[model samples]
Target: MSGTPATALDFPGEVVTQAHVRYVALPGVAGPLALVTLDNGLDHTRPSTFGPAGLRSLLAAADEIEAHTPAVSAVAVTGKPFIFSVGADLAFRSSLRDPEAARAGIHAIGELGHAALRRIGEGHFGGRKVPTFALVNGAAMGGGLEVALHCDYRALSSDVTALALPEVFLGLLPGWGGTQLLPNLVGADRAVTIAIENPLNQNRMLRAAQAFALGLADVLLEPADFLEEALRWAARVIRGEIDPAAARAPVRRGAVWA
Candidate 1:
């Protein structure tokens, strides 16, 4: 199976499964898959992008997931131009814009992402087992990386894919789950080091092999073959060849930023 391979119904009718948050869900080669595609090559969903009514609809839409979601055996998210995710919407941070409104929207939408992620992880597809895989197709930092962390497995792109929690640069830590999940995947020592090192550009980001070596990824494969390789991994999980593990919270970094 491949990353969210589209399937056809027996009647050849178009099947549409509305995804949650800024994310979208579709059938993969093996099971149900969701994709967290970045908008305009940037991170976060636009406040102006989804109005209050629209947000309500999108958030409430997950209920249907309990009814429509299939067994999630594989998933992949690609950032535009080799960038996985740029974190939350820049518009949300523009102080001169509006923090109050942004905060409200964040709370509202954040809850949705939380539930959607949990559903993806726990929701059942059939009498069999379910597994989730995240393919860090490119640079995934901050919130984008947080999203990747939620998956049962993460496979970063071998081609210079940088992962980080740069929320400190913005005078914040990853509020989403980066602070916790990152260290859980790689370990407190390496996670803290990556954060403090503060690699400036994406080019400086670690590749999949290094990530795997760091325990961040299970394997490292070429970008050209990323999806195919991910499918291979997913198949193993589906076939009971792999067991899932829990991720831990990142230890608090002391004076590293100061």
Candidate 2:
């Protein structure tokens, strides 16, 4: 896949959006899996935030992964150490002056994010429908959580400190499929708590344990070898060694109290 031109969009700050891809072969697994890591050059302090250029970069990476020869059996997306992503680049939005310009910019951002996420959700890479997973290693709020929700399955690290849809606190909503996908995954009441009620109540964030109880994560692993564990879990699911229904049954009861 061709890279997005540098002139395509002017992003704020020195954010260098990039996707690092690698293939991993799991024991007893039939085929190699594609693993994509999202990064923004900055350390965990900056957190990966999506802007127009950043979204385009992700799209390019997805395209490239889809075109891989021999066809991967599945795909997994993860983030840098101690961070999944904070969400959209609010700094970029803060730069707009005119209302019309701001509206158009916001619309464009939502469209780009949705399109790329939809492709991942449907596993529509290179004319195939492979299973997709999200390994949320740390904080994942707003658009970041939406990205995770788009995946077929998600795993979380016990070290994760924050998870929520805080757009409502900022006088906005999760316009990038969060409202729809969240309710479908975790039920309407909990979706309201995470996307609305909690945001209104000082933007409360869910700890990793809370998220697991809410059924947002299929598996929770210790930070030590978190990715390796998540990869193994994905392979087990793909190979029919683990039952997704059984895995979710225990969490479904926990969501009642979450």
Candidate 3:
């Protein structure tokens, strides 16, 4: 029997996932910064995962940011309390049986994710290059890290326990820009370790400090004050007080490692 195409497969009914937008002003930044929170109305244990509905919600939030009154000087994305986001809903993919169907499903997911995230990555909002930041307050894995990578700057909480691309471990690659963006940001060698070697080695994860040291995160702050600190940091970045280049500079690995 011919297998059903992924696009033809039925997705579960929309969940309660939605993006909540908050406008806050910092001392030095012009106008207010639009903070978009990804929430699923569940506890941290459940973790926020992206499905088609979730992606639509995020696109809507991006629209709202573009249309904000008084305008926004910057945009920032974070997760509820802890747990930034665990990435795409694996259950959606698991439902596919045919290889072609699986490829179709993955393609749809990638297109939607890139469409939404690219808006943030290019800093395109209201026809302007609005600075974007990711406040990674907790576990950010797979697509979650990719989302953070899309942002111009990233801030991680001191308690983040899982930050990595574990797709290889599950017989997948970083489909959503991870393969392209990571190497450019962290260099070819480190990217190999993160995208290939690490996953094969029992899917090693990075702590907050390690992520920062690897140039994956711009700053690390205590979980207690992470959001506030991220906002302050965003203000500095918006005001041109911090150099984006220096903030994104890759760490120099010693020759011993090579």
- lDDT (Cα, tens digit) per residue for candidate 2, span 20-136: 788898888766788988898878888998887778777887887788886788889899988887888888788767899788777767777787677666676656788899999
Please report the candidate that would top lDDT against the real structure: 2
Clashing pairs in 3: none
lDDT of each: 0.51, 0.82, 0.81
Superposed model 3: Cα runs more than 4 Å off:
1-10, 13-16, 98-100, 250-258
TM-score of 1: 0.64
Candidate number with greatest TM-score: 2
Task: List clash counts for every candidate, in order.
Answer: 4, 0, 0
Worst ten-residue run, lDDT, model 2?
A: 1-10
In angstroms, the error of model 2 at 74 is: 0.5
Quote the lDDT for 73 in model 1.
Answer: 43
lDDT (Cα, 0-100) at 51 in candidate 2: 80
